[model samples]
Target chain A: MFSASVGLSRNWEPFDAGEEIVINTLEKLEGEPKFFLLFPTIHFEKNNGFQKLLDGVFSQLNRSTPLLGCSVAGFINPKGCYTRGVTSLAIADPDMQVTIALGKNAKKTPQKAAEEFANMIKKEKSKNNSGVLFLILPGSTLPKDIFHRTRRISNPLLSSLFDKFFPLYLALSKEGVAKESEFIDKLYSRISEKMIGISAWDNNLGFSNYQFFGNRVLQNSAVGLYLSFSGEITIKYATPLKIFSEKLRVTKKDNSNYLINEINGLNAPDLFFKELKLEKKYLTEELLRKITLGFPISAYCGNIFFNRVIGLYSDKFLGLTTALNTPEIYISTASGSSIINSFDKVTDGGEKTNFVFGVSCAVLLEEVGSKIFEVKNILEKKQIKNFLFLFGGSEHFMTEVTPISSQESSVTTFF
Target chain B: MSEETMLSVLEDLLKEEDVLAIMLARKNEISVSPPPDKFKLKNPSIFSLLQSTMNEFFVVIEKFSSQGLDKIYFELGEYELMFFLIGGDTALVSIIPALANKGLLEVEMENARLKIRELIQKGV
Candidate 1:
């Protein structure tokens, strides 16, 4: 029957405003929360000031405290939203238990390590204690090459991505170049067949809710912990809805620059512009627009799969990623209904969990918008009190949102 | 030996029938005289070629010769390929493109071989 009430007061002080924001939060949480998680909203593009803010925040935290957090797209609180921000979840679960296990940087497998840790929980703890594992994997560790076959099929201009989006890029392959313009047109017709399909998802953050916690940029790689505990863990995720009317892919890229191309003949950033049908090119194409790489996660063929706008490329036709040939992207047409549904279908549950920790995508701040209040209202309907959420990449394979589960959430070991 | 034993041995070598299928080649003379239906690899010489490519063959030299290893792993560069040996002359080989974590799989195979040896020696 405990309540989570957040008070927000934005700071306008030009110098170290971020520090004030977190300091105020610490003061509010001073009365030792049954268990409090601290997540400082980090906006590094803001660079300079972020450092002092982090140092100050870190100084205040108990080094022994397990903080389940990440680099965010934005943050949320009662104060509304912004790209540069942070937030924390304070809990009071007298019956709760949690712990965090650090994975060997790039050496050991996250799953095996987490499972070993999960098994380490005291066998004497009434054998009925259920827990979750929350993983915060490093985003840079990804597999070598799944799309090596694509190198043989080339459009010359768009062959580089043959390494990642391999299965679908075969549409533009040529038996032998026949007619020039006609063949080019035929190529576009063929490209339409090359639809984006989700390959294996790496959400083995040890808990069931592997869907939450990373960015589209964080897709190829991952990190986090497995959360195991001693009972019933509660959790869910949410995202706004929109559908694509036009689509594009970046077939060729070099760093940020991409030679964007697509199956429909739409070139460069125009495909996104046309897909959204928004006239202002400046707003849609801007680098800092905080555009959510909206993806749809649905059940297909009895397995969970994600469909989304993978990432953004530069604003050049040759570097047309933002302009053209990026991988598959979805254009939002309408909003989703379950202001609470995205978070509804969680990873399959079995172990009993009395508490959980959540690390959410920074972008959820935008997608949830004012509706975050509505989502919170929905949560108020539940009795889940021990929980924490921080803004960062969706953490796994989600385009817009990711949440670490109790199994993946990091907390000091308490059986 | 027995057809049952041969089939079991062949199945052990092939792993799965999905992609790579190991087939036995019947020697010509044997086929004509006894309908031998024998088996040999099309490219046994590839092993010789590999040995020559490396300028030396690392044969029975063992970490513990008395213990006798049930398996040995070879790392072929360029391809980073791996091949394993089991039961003396019988060899389990794989090309990189068609292989997955051969070194790791070799450990499991060795464990299985050791157990089989134990069962045989124990009259089980």
Candidate 2:
């Protein structure tokens, strides 16, 4: 359905190093690209070179084609994974129509902003009637205004009191997460027919950095790229976490899954360590990544086991990526071997020999270390040509009219 | 009590052949039992889609009050969208395949609604 070429460059001395590779990517393409999707690493963000490099590429393209990209921790391509270079995927498909929309001021009303962006593109004409909407959302926190609006407690005093005790409540509230999810939901609901592509997260640049880009404008927004394809497309995703034999019941927890005092009738943190068999001194970033990305609570739904990634951990309580909240109980454990096995399982089949784009969990790179290269080798052996991968904080995919957030998982769509 | 009741109800819904997906949303936030992975409604927009559908349907319902229509039903190709207000900002949404027995589905939904009501009344 498409032809794509990828280019990478570690030289950032002249600020044109990345652009040189980008130009080479376009030259390598069989035909004129409809659009360009750039995934540049944090190294490009140094010395304010991200924008400079973006401008350089824009100047080279001369505004002839649409450019959309996000700042990523790292990226992967047909060759291998890269941490210090720019990975540009130039897609050339005459049968596919692409629309790029940026939702400005996403920090304020992420849901609404995203809806507007999706709506704008949906209003345009799609060639094939069958396409995919690939979303790139910001990883940073929503604006405080959105949080306050979410509270909706009405009584300022009551809300303040709740906030005083649970300071992170407003920030990590399930409601806040739901709002973002709802935004993606609404977008999909508006256009249910389009196969939703893997949604990538731009490394949270906090409030200062420009998180997303469309054309030449860098802004805090959700960028939705609508690609209408005339041919066939397939998608495969792997959460890469499995439940251990032992099951742990949540004996007690707050409204959010953050403050869990006990699990399986024992201290939460103690149970976590005992079940995983880890030493306290070895709780480094590497191990933490393995746990958060590899070990996820298993929840049974239909015939599949969906793994929920853990967000934070402390001596007192354990946190989860999303608030599974009250009445949700499950067992979870992390093993590098299990994660590697799960990756192999998920990547079993359904891959096409044509164009492919994937977004892998950035944290997984820190955890599995060398296994990532093995994964690349597997893909290479599979002979997946013209493929690009983005390593980021979170990966997004939509199915059945909703967007699902996954960690330690790689989402790849084949066209 | 509330969690168990809701979870059990959802589990029951899964047994139905036509129930492609079932989810519950409270104040626009989805609290689906068995999680999104099970029903495959993991799309973040599913809640908003249901919420918006209900919101728009209610507006139409309020406008056509004279017709005495107490329920809303809609279809999208092969999927049947149905929902019942389970009281207090909560709505149970079910996406069923068109081939399913609609009558039987309604009966199951009503029974589930009653259980949810009991939980609400008991403050569980």
Candidate 3:
């Protein structure tokens, strides 16, 4: 039998929060958990706090249990949405087996890291076992070297000029994300099977996000959990996007296909504005945020279309969060009602299961705000008693034909 | 407002760059802005293809009328075609370069569709 319990601690102190989470979880879990998943907010990472939190957790449970997780923007549980504190999911099953793997230097050498991560899992799992891969990696594309260099510019005038041309820096940062996508592609090619997970994120979209492997805190790395269960596993996903514009061809793009330079013989931004009937003069930071939240570019890949949220743009280019493999794309928008309604749609039609692991895009959580409680209500209506939902920067899932990385909400239920 | 005024409104859309042609079909009547000869020499088969496609599109519009479908867009060879339904029996079609300012053109077409709808409602 499969049993799962979620533990949440809102204590301000990191060590106390960790202890409370373990005590809270162990009180209801009945037995020693085989696997433990941690989803802590960035708040605990201050002043070596993550290590202290992990110490507290280890103080309570066996140090050998497979534990893997990452810092999140926030998370949702039956209790409600929380932006601060640590939440954990502990699972105990007699027929389920899990193996943990870690690949370092994900940003610098993605292909090598992917090989290490995949090779570890492949060597550990038995040949006849049907395994599911859960991955968490650093999601930020902000180039640390450039950012530190820019910070060292002491001249006021030079700093102001750099600020004025910030979009260029943003475009450069997007190249890292393109590399990460390539890394994911490599992982998919090596481990061609079911996969579902998210990328680590922080509250402010900063570079403070960290992944947890057992008692250690890691950055710029990929962590995986290979689970082979003898029972049924159901995966449900929802990304209700409405297509608004007709198909537009990508006439030109950067080498990585992450930075689009031209579309339909016009500058990427120019074509985007023209299609939306907006003027260039009215563009502002606020307007850009609204545009990114409302209108995301949807590119067709394999047999499905995946969304690529616009993260950076200038007069000459449009930087997307994910790589675009196809030349054809359509402008799409998501409404608040549609996002909320997706909860019901995703939770529906699946066999009734008590244990569920959900991952949603942090941007969507920020967009929906307090309306996220409706998701908890939907889960309650579906009779899901114990579940853990995390909000990360990006969500990943494997389609029938290929792997897809996009801004989506998904739930993986094990019965 | 008469058909001449409606045609003039569509002519304004041609002011934008790369807009090849505009066609307005109302029941048994048809109107093409900039005349057919201007672009007929450049691409002679465009008009015939538009005529045949519009007939089949009208049939589709009738079938999906209950769903309140108002717009249809598709790419044909090197050009893009956008068809907007004006009232029950009238359709406004614009043919433009594949890379034209589609967003701005959409707004312009909506304005033109509204103007033509008012004219048709007035028994022009």
Candidate 4:
């Protein structure tokens, strides 16, 4: 018999309690816990419980216990959001490699982190497409170098494309997560799946018989996880929806996590916003929301819509990292339907799902209301039990190689 | 909202051949065209609709030069659907999908602004 349980918990402010939940959840998952994943939902009721929670979790993992989890946007269980703590726990082989790390601690980019995390997978390793690397980075950092994706693809292709299997993921933080239950209902999944910033279909928690999470590797809290086997990890993404204006070359770049001496061949953020017919704040808010939604929000809270991002060419803003110039910088745009269709086709009662985090459109949130979050429970009910779904807003939760300046420190890959 | 415009916009954005209707809404009522059949305004006054779209989104109100500027959505079949916005109180709101040629859309959007201005003035 497959034994599995899930622990769901939350800590409201004032009480400042995360340690108790972690202790209990870890206790439940200890001995035979195949893989333990945690999605901490703070801010909704701020209480400084996170440190306690992290401390509790750290104490439990026994130094890299093959565990993966992240902070959540909103959480769910049989009951409502009255308290914060683990709701369930389980024991079984989801067949996934898991890792945990706070955003700041993960020095290298998530892809590299995944490579390191994958080595921890004892089960198997194959020359073919083993498993996909899931990168989770902190939302606050707003992942700087996503253009590294192309590099990921090319690297894998060289020696049978190990990097190709790695897809990038961002981790959204407090502001996004606090908005979780904004709309608990009213979303039309079948239709709006094409509407980015509206919905995500990749994962289903609507409880079913089988399990998900199998055959997948997980990187929790911006910590990367890579499972090595032979099956291909198919990737579909749309970034940088609109160039907004002529693509500019980066004159000088370095990743110091601060906007220091940045020279864009163009007027920088100003020109880009002018082309979009908006202001700087709009772009920041929109992109931040997009990162939270894991997609772009065309219609603001169902108000007015625009083209969403498909992908980004980091070098376009190359000055942010390498002191070189990236000529072609384009933002991707596409409908939400195809993504949903893919999720629809791939999801199954018995299919194992590893890790999934996404952002839903604010307008969709307005449209669906509470359904935006209630879907968590619905999905939990619909998906196979094996799958571990950690949902949050758009925040790049991966470690990117930030080329430091002459005065700063250099961060090379670990392991 | 005209099916043609809605169809084109939806096709480009969601890649959907089928689009019911799009709306620009707020609390209870319509600031533009009367609420369509399936659409109903909210409980608040007229400003609610305007606030819904612009307030939190870091929106701006620009009195168009012989044009208008408003982007909002409305309700359709219990589905608050539609891409058409209520522009400039007396203006125009245009939809530009990222996929299509960016330059061309910019021009067309400008023209649409003029047309919306003329219409708003004529009250036709």
Candidate 5:
């Protein structure tokens, strides 16, 4: 029998939050939990709070309980949708095998770090074991100088112009998604198991988030949890986006292929604004956020369309949060109604779900705001009783032959 | 609470950037911030319609479930309407732009509702 429970603590004190989380979860869970998944908000990282939090957690349970987690923007559980606090899920299943692996300095050496992570999991699992992999990688890591430079620009249009003219400087400064993509590519080369996870993020787009492995708190790391289970696993996703523009071909790109310089033989940013009928000079941070939330670049992955949020933009180029493996793409838009309605269809298929673990783009949280609680309400209406839903910088899942990184939402249901 | 004090509370809620209007309704009486003429000129029937709908919806919910209705939200094209049930027969209604930061607004609304409740207890 498999048993799972989710707990959340809004206590400001880190140690208390950790203790409260364990107490709340263990009270509902049966027997000894095989694994604990922690999702702490970035607020707990202050004053070495993560370490103290871990100390409190280990005080209650076994010292060796495998725990893997990362800083998230916020989370939604049975209690409520919260922006600040710690939430955790505990699973007690004797038949399931859980293994954890962490690779450090992922930004500095992605391929090497991924190899270290993949090799650890590869050695632990037999070839015949059917399982799913959960990953938590570092969020955007724009260098200090570049981040400060961008912060100093009060006008977004000027910032866009600056990035467009000095592409090399911006390229050298940002290393989050590009490095993470490389890490995923290299890890897939070693392991063939289906993967689903998210990149850790803070409420602000500050790019400084931590990952937890056992009792250790880390940054710029890749953490993976492989669960080898004999039961069934169902993967479902919701992309609250629809095609807004006709298909356009990528005519020019940067060396990394993540930056689009020209689309349909025209300047990428110019065409983007023109197609959306947006005034370039009037662009502000709020407007940019609205565009990122409502209008994302969509491309075909397998049979379904995968959406990528715009990360960086300049007059000369458009940078996406994830690199597209295809040249054909279209702009997609989402409304408040569409976003809320899409959650109704997320768990449509017939499957007896025992527990659900969900990861959604933080952009959705920003878009919905307090309306996020309505999403939890919708899931409950679908009869999903036990679940932990988190908001992160990006969501990741694997297709049959390729790994897909998106800004939408995905759920991994265990039965 | 005096009429001036009640108006002050409603005015404070309107200070939020995206909050277009605010109304406090109890039984058949309704108090609208910025008065009814100035803001209601855009949508004359929405307020009364929403009030009636909320009451009807509450009746349906009370009949079907043991849980009390706490809040209701409606996304109407470019605008969003929210209702927060206060004590007694009173409720707070707010109209905001669709893109407003609802999470933050919810906290603000809760705070406003508490203030309104306190005022009501003191005799509004």
Candidate 6:
């Protein structure tokens, strides 16, 4: 009852690429799709004309079909994770009931905005309880608003730090009563009992160019899409980081994601370098990658080790790719071999999936470097018919019960 | 790492017998020390509700301080909540029991803040 096609095209010309992708996708689909999900790389979004081009191509394809899109850091098609291009999935299913609500204004609390959007969907379609919903928002980070009232600092270094740290804080604050996760919890609390689904973070993928379009809403809004299927849908996440160090607690932290004031009782950067047995004097890009591979921060929930990666480092702090407010954290690491093993583990069950959607960490590609293609080839070998991978700075996949984000993992939704 | 030292400090502070729960907030977040499930607050939802409202308060305060504001206090019946702006965006929040000595708790909170600041200043 449900069928979809994945399309990807890399014409640097944004307008031409948009039309070409749509045409190629339509060729592969059996009939007109009721919904189309667009995922374009951050570079594609940087071209100011991309949005108009998207509107033109999307409307031309089918005015009746609703279009939902977000800027992505990177996206995946059958070919694997590509740094550039547009990747999309078109879905046409008569049994699925769909409803969408949008929340505008970047300054509003993400939690409140999501709640309003979810409430609207719930109010309109309270009768249907069997489907899933996808909450799509612009990528987590945005360029620091120098003009904003909160950021009036005049010093360029301080301004740059504030700009970078503020958005990262919003993205990485997951545990406790934090910004990003708080919004997620509020939204989830509103509709978790009635429906099942996940929230997708789309920004210029990893670039700060965050935008989302759906219904009457444009950029700077949280868009909630409600989907009810006559058939069943199963969802699960794949966490790839393996813990390598003993558990330690986050004793202190600053408001920004870039700086950890303290971990355990020692200064964070000191403890980080000390534990790795690496000298600060010899720090290099290769060493940084190796350290990132070996020392991801993992939070213990029940018995599971939920991991977060530190991609950026300075004398001040260790930058967390995934948000955390939990007091306890452990050192975690990922390797090319381990990631491949995780891919095999996730896909080995043979679920006879009609479609498998992958959301992977951009850090994995950074750490693995050119070896990403090897992992891609492994994914390609999967017996499952259709699989698309999306690579971003961070990846979030959630069900009603367990919602988490990771830097070295892949969360795949099987349909 | 330094978890032991900080936990010991928190342990010493909690030994005051009147401190029921201690929490930390950075920006719009509130994290209960000893974890919420273990320490158990009477109404956790109240903290979340207030956190959202306090965000507005922060927005207004930003207009006054280019460097950001430092420290705020609140009294609700028998409870006390102390908020300290540390490391710019981070807030060190502490909740004290009604029967505890307010003056003593404030001093302890300052001590913890100073130690945290020292750790940050001595970055690797």
The candidate maximizing lDDT is: 5
Highest TM-score: give the candidate number. 5
Please report the interface RMSD of model 2 to 1 decimal: 23.8
> Which lDDT value does model 2 have at B15?
47
Which whole-number lDDT from 0 to 100 does residue A58 have in model 3? 88
lDDT of 6 by residue, A93-120 (tens): 7666778777554224667676687777
Off by over 4 Å in 2: A125-128, A140-182, A193-210, A215-220, A245-271, A277-294, A300-304, A323-331, A334-352, A400-402, B1-124
Task: Tell me, per candidate, how large a share of the native contacts it keeps.
Answer: 0.00, 0.00, 0.00, 0.00, 0.19, 0.00
**Candidate 4: fraction of native contacts reproduced:** 0.00
- When summed lDDT is taken over every stretch of 10 residues in candidate 5 chain A, the lowest stretch is A146-155
* Each candidate: RMSD: 25.2, 25.8, 19.0, 18.8, 8.4, 23.3
The residue ranges of model 5 lying beyond 4 angstroms of the native Cα positions read A143-178, A349-351, B1-124
Lowest-sum lDDT 10-residue window in model 4 chain A: A406-415
lDDT of 1 at A106: 17
Give the TM-scores of the predictions, in the order they appear: 0.39, 0.63, 0.71, 0.38, 0.77, 0.65
| Candidate 2 colliding pairs | A185-B44, A185-B45, A186-B45, A301-B38, A402-B43, A402-B44, A403-B43, A403-B44
Which stretches of candidate 1 lie above 4 Å from their native place?
A1-36, A44-51, A78-83, A92-95, A104-128, A138-230, A237-305, A312-391, A395-415, B1-124
Q: Cα deviation in Å at residue B49, candidate 2?
A: 64
| Candidate 3 segments whose C-alpha is farther than 4 A from its true place | A143-178, A408-411, B1-124
Candidate 1: what lDDT? Answer: 0.32
Report the lDDT tens digits of candidate 5 across residue range A1-415: 8899999887768898889889998999987888888898877877899998887788786777899889988888877777767899999988889888988888667788899999899888756667889999888755555653132344578656655554464345435554667789899988878888899887645457888999999888999899898855666777888899999999998656667888999998889989999988988655765675578899887777788777766666777766665799999988767777766666564225777777888777777666777877776777778878888878888746777778865544445
Tell me the lDDT of model 3 at A180.
57
DockQ per candidate: 0.01, 0.01, 0.01, 0.02, 0.14, 0.01
How many residue pairs clash (N, CA or C atoms closer than 3 angstroms) in each of the candidate models, in the order given?
79, 8, 3, 122, 3, 14
